[model samples]
Target chain A: MALPGIASFLVTIGTLACIWGLLALGLNVHYGYTGLLNFGHVAFFAAGAYASAVLTMPPPEQVSQANYVIGLDLPMPLGFPVSLAVAALAGGLLALLIGSTSVRLGSHYLAIATFALAGIFEDVLVNETWLTNGTFGMNSVPKPMRETLGAGGWQVAYLAFSALCLLGVYLLLDRLIDAPFGRLLRGVRESEDAARMLGKDTNLVKLKSFAIGGAIAGFAGGLYAHFLGSVVTEQFVAGVTFVVWAAILLGGVASSSGAIVGAFLLIAFQQSTRFILTIYGWIQSVLPEPLSGVLPAIFAPLPDHPSFVPSVRFIVIGCLFVLVIRYRPEGLFGDPNEVTVMGEEE
Target chain B: MASALSQFLQAVAFGLVEASVISVGAVGLTLSYGVTRFINFAYGEFLAYGAFLAFFLSGAGAGVVGLPVAAVVAVLLVGALGVAVSRVFFRPISDRGALPLLITSIGVAFILRYLLIAGASAEARQLPVPLMRPVEVAGVGLTPLELGVVAVSVVTMLAIHLLLQRTMLGKTMRATSGNRSLAEVAGIDTDAVIRKTWFISAAAGGLAGILYGVLFAPFRPTFGFGYLIVVFAATLLGGIGRPYGAMLGAVLIGLMISLGSTYLSASYDQAYAFIALVGVLLLRPEGIRGGEF
Candidate 1:
């Protein structure tokens, strides 16, 4: 496959990085700040994506071909924020329900419950054909200012919009964390017993953080839908959670700017490595036979192998994760002192 | 009414088969979790590895060994592997919390799962075993292979019961789980006990894998990964860290999944498990055997 020009690639990857930055920011608030170990974060993300996609999409030309709840027929700019709000509300409500029950069960059980919930969410998306189009996904999504701006210009606008949203989320979280409410959340994470003794409603504090995080996740998902002009169920796998987690952990837990840096780093690494495969094929083609023969066909089957790319990607990421977790838990952009895990004094 | 009773009975029997499979994995999970306090998400990977290992052992021309022998070797090999992984991966970390350990296990899970996909064929492969006649008892049909799975699971559970209840090592493990620092003070080697716990846990997981692979033909490397949700549900339902509770939990979950799916759409089997899990957690957060856990 011919590679896209550098500009298109940058615009595409940069937008995704910003979107994921928003996701990492949300997770940082939940896991890093409030100490909630949510294993099934994808549920909220999927909820938001579906909410926005269904809300903004124009009805299919053939009604029999597609069916979904709402089609406001509003322009892109008008629909985007509305859909985003709807997504955030869906995410917040889901989080509130799960958090209220799961947090009371403590961290371990809460993690398992959330993981199960995520699985159920995936199943629902696949089976609820009327809603998610049964895995064909929503392709009719209107981007923010797409009609006026044209495709390339539209992408540029999305990149800017996502950056603005990321900034807003970061500032909102930074302010919240600096406030008394943030301290209460930290107290809940550091020591529940101590927080309770200090007259803080620890459960309530945790619940609040989780719901806020969920809202942010919803917003991020909605933004991604408009950016792509499409939303698919496959986009909301548990792996997405891990990828975002890796970002925040790598960038530095709890710091909002670190979330962006970490996301950029992750997306850059993945895209660059994918570029390696393209380079490999290019080299094989341009090497002019005899030199290529001398290079020893060690990767002979790699081009044809289906699992090689994803497996190698995951293996590299997993090894990096292990290494970071072991030595530099503070991450590249984070303060050394603000590791997400509690009860460990270095 | 007669048909409904028969259907219920059939569902109960099918549930028993699933419960036995779940119980094997849950025992190992609860055992290690009791001692170490980390929910080993890689336990699912252990199942995958063992199942694939058994497939490799059964002489489909490329196999290193065959069944019965393959089964025993798979169990022991996985047990040893469990200790090795814990040593290399988990033992070095000084600080312990649910998040760090949970995240690490997720990494392990990723590596093991993809490693299988990369090293071996991603296509589904069944354990090369002879076909057995289906046996009927009280209007419910059971395959000879399913009977073998039940037998193997029961034997392993019995062995675990004996090791935990009768042996000195078992007593020490119990003590360590009951109160680790106290057990260490009383001259028990907590590290050794923890290692032993991992071995037992992984071995049980392996047994479950082999049974599941053999009975449930056309399984891919992701076979165990798919059922991971159900496994966790059983472990949580039984109460984490309590083997007996895990057993009861597995039975309950298995029955619920089988009967519920039979009545409902089969596609929603995993969802049913989650529903049961949430309901139980909300109604009785402690679980039936939660106190012991």
Candidate 2:
């Protein structure tokens, strides 16, 4: 990697980390603070991304070959806030809709239901081509202040913007976690019966927590859409949901800062796997013939195919998921007692 | 009008075939839930693996006896794999409530799926079943293979019913599912029952997968995973823990998907299944038959 290569790589990684960090942060609100098992979280993210993209993109008449149906073509100043607000509202409303019924059920049921919802969202994205341009995603998504910032500076600017959003959300969540509402959320997670005995409307509290968490996730989706400069259905899959789950689990459930660290570390791990072949080649060249031959032989079982690297990554991630749950269920930063998602026998 | 009626009948015929496949799969899933009290998310992978194994074996010169023998071998092997997986990965953490078990199942599912992708490659492969022309039955065209699939599924379901109702193992399973501690107190050997249940359930799942492949050829690594939600809808609709309910739910979902795809849009086939699941989950979480297995 040259200086520019490293810089651009860092910028891209930093940008993605911040977006994922936002998602993890929101998930922490749902899973960590409220103990809601929201398995289909990518739906909210997709909603936010699509909402932002559709709101900001040029009208159908403006683009010569417009595949999508909706485009408000709002200017950046008006578009950014409106789009984000829409995203947040969309996510919050969706959470409210899903959470109303499933929040009261066992976390496992909630997980299954949410997982289905995400699948439905993906199906819609793929099938309803008129809405999201089907499999061929919409292109040339407008960025905030892209005209003001030159092409070279846009990446840096976007990275900064995403980081700030992550920070802001973190601080906001911190305050919320300490507040009475947060206590109520925790109360519901700990023991709904006990909370109900104390005259707390636990269901309402849970629903609110779910909505807030969803809103945050939706907001991150808006930022992600602008970062990518295009919204594709492939980007929002069930795998993304698992990745966010891994982040929360790795970081430590119920810890805001832990979620950020987990998100960044996971993003870094995913990115680093792309260099597996390069790393292997470097090792082979640096070592003696015997050692190089032995190393290649040892790692020969591991895929050399670039296309298969993603599969290897997922296999590792899946292992991590099982290992984390089996050995360190509370995660690195979480107190075992504070974690109630995996509570008493159902 | 005649064409529309034929189209409707055709959908019904196709729906019945789809139902047969789903019934086996759903029953497999529900059986585990009944005994072990956790939905094995990797059950779909069991089905996929079963189909893949059969595909490999049948392709490797099994000839006339190849498909049936391969399916039997695959089912038993996958059943054993299921037992081993639960013994190693699930049984130790089984005490940690259903939520952790559920999450762990998801992990197992991911591992199994990706590993399949790595080993078999991501490309779709068709099972080596000769294509047969569709036979018209009262204006509805049904392939010979499709009728065979339905017949095999019905036989399997009947066998399972006998296993659950008449056999000592079935009695023990029912007792264990009803109340684990009580069954233990009654000296039923709940662990053995559970192990046996796992084998049966996983075997059924594998059988279902093989049938799916036979009817719907050219399946990828994700074939079973993609069909998982629809199976879920069926399981939930018939009632989660009841094998009979699963059969009912499978029939309903199969019809819904087939009819909806024909009438609405082919692309939204799975979406219709999801809608059925959501409706059941919301309107009647307990399912049609809400009680004991």
Candidate 3:
């Protein structure tokens, strides 16, 4: 790939990292800050992606071969803003419902509940073919300014837009964490019983945190949908949810900067793994056949087609997670004090 | 109306058989959780590993008798892996918190899944075993393999019960799960109990996987990934720490899925498990048998 090509790839990955960073930040609020272990954060992401996709897709009667949901004929300016709002709203609503029922449970129960909900959402997306187009996925969902500015210009515009979104979210979340409500959330994380004794409805605060965090995730999802020019149920798998959690851990779970930094490092590491494997094929071939065969087997299944390197990326991420946990449980930017945030209730 | 009734019964039977597999899987999960006090997110991987091991072993010309040996080997291998993971990854963070361990387990799951996908062909591979010829009972047909699954599940449960009640190791495991520090103080060798727990739990999971592969006929790399949520639901529904509760919970979930699919869309089968889990949590968080949460 040329420099520009690599730049675009990096940009695409950077955009993803930013989006995940945002989501991980939201998770940081729930898991890291509040000590709530939510294993199903992707449900919100899916809700956001599906909500935006559904809202923007042209009505069934007006559907065209292009698969752009917002209809190419519609004014782009109006559609983009609506899509983002819809995503956030949908995610917030889901978080509300989930929180109302599951959040009251202990951390383990809450984690399982969220995990189940994520699976349920994926099931709905896959089985409700009429609603979200099943596994075929919604494609050509109008990239912001793609038609008018062309692909290159649109990519550049999206990169800028996504970065702005990331910065805005980072600052907002940082401010929130410093505020009274944030401190209360941390209080709840430190000691739910003490928070309860202090006349705080820890449940309500946790619910609100979950809702707001989910809304942020939704915003990221909307951005992701528009940037990728598609939304699919596959994108919302439990694997993705865990990746966000991994990123949160890698970056320093409770730190806003950690989410962003972790997302970048994790994605970069994954991409680099692929680059290394591809470049070393000649070296691999020269090794003993049995050794070579076993060596490749040690990695994730490499697809016959070159473009589908995501599976390998997942394997590397998994390995990295194990290593990170074993070596640096506090995460890259994690504070030793923050460790108590996740410790068991005494 | 008669046909509908028959269909419902058949679905229930199918669900019972399916539940047998899930019950086995859930029991393993519950046992591990009971002792470790953290959900082993990689529990499903044990099942996958077992099935794949059986797949390879059978492919290498292991016959009917070889099935049990393959299962044992897979369980032992996975148990060793579990012990290694616990020592290297889990023990380090054992005092830190659950979130890190949870993430690590999830990573282990992904690694195992991808490893299988990388080592084995992406396409679904059939176990090199003859299909159990289907037998009709009151106009509801079930394959012999399915019947074997149910029978083996019962047998396994009984064996587990006997082992837990009668054996010294089982007693030690129970003691360890009940209170690790106390068990250690009482000279139970808590670490050894934990290692044994992993071996037994993982072995049970592996057996379940092999049986599932036998009953289902073919297995895919991501098969266990798809089933993990439902299994987790069953485990939780049965209460997090009780093995028998897991078995019963799995049966209920299986029945719900089977019956729900017949009445509703097939796609909603998984949703049934989630619904059951939520219902159980709402009504009886400790599960039907009522144990430690």
Query: How accurate locally, in lDDT, is each candidate?
Result: 0.82, 0.86, 0.80
lDDT string for model 2 (B1-293, tens) is 99999989899999999999999999999999998888777888988998988987786434444788888998999899889989988998998888788878888888988888887778787787888999987898888899999999999999999999999999999999899999999999999999999999989989999999998888888887888888899998998889999999999999999999999999888888888888788888888877778
User: Which of 1 and 3 is the better model by lDDT?
Assistant: 1
Return the TM-score for each candidate structure: 0.94, 0.96, 0.91
Docking class of 3: acceptable
iRMSD for each candidate structure, in the order shown? 2.3, 2.3, 3.2
**lDDT of candidate 2 over A1-346, digit per residue (tens):** 1237778888999999999998999898888877788888999888888888888888877775677788888788667888888988887888888788677766766777888877888998888777787777877678787777766588898888889888998999889889988888888888788999999988888889888988888898888887888899999988898999999998989999999999999999999888877887897899976676798678778654444778878888888789998888878888787765437353
The most accurate candidate by lDDT is: 2
TM-score for predicted model 1 compared with the true structure: 0.94
Q: Model 1: residues >4 Å from true position, as ranges?
A: A1-4, A60-74, A285-304, B94-98, B130-133, B290-293
TM-score of chain B of each: 0.96, 0.97, 0.92
Instruction: Output the worst ten-in-a-row residue range by lDDT, candidate 1 chain A.
Output: A61-70
The most accurate candidate by DockQ is 2
Cα misplacement distance, residue B249 of candidate 3 (Å):
1.0
The superposed Cα distance between candidate 3 and the true structure at residue A130, in angstroms, equals 2.0
Name the lDDT value of residue A283 in candidate 3: 74
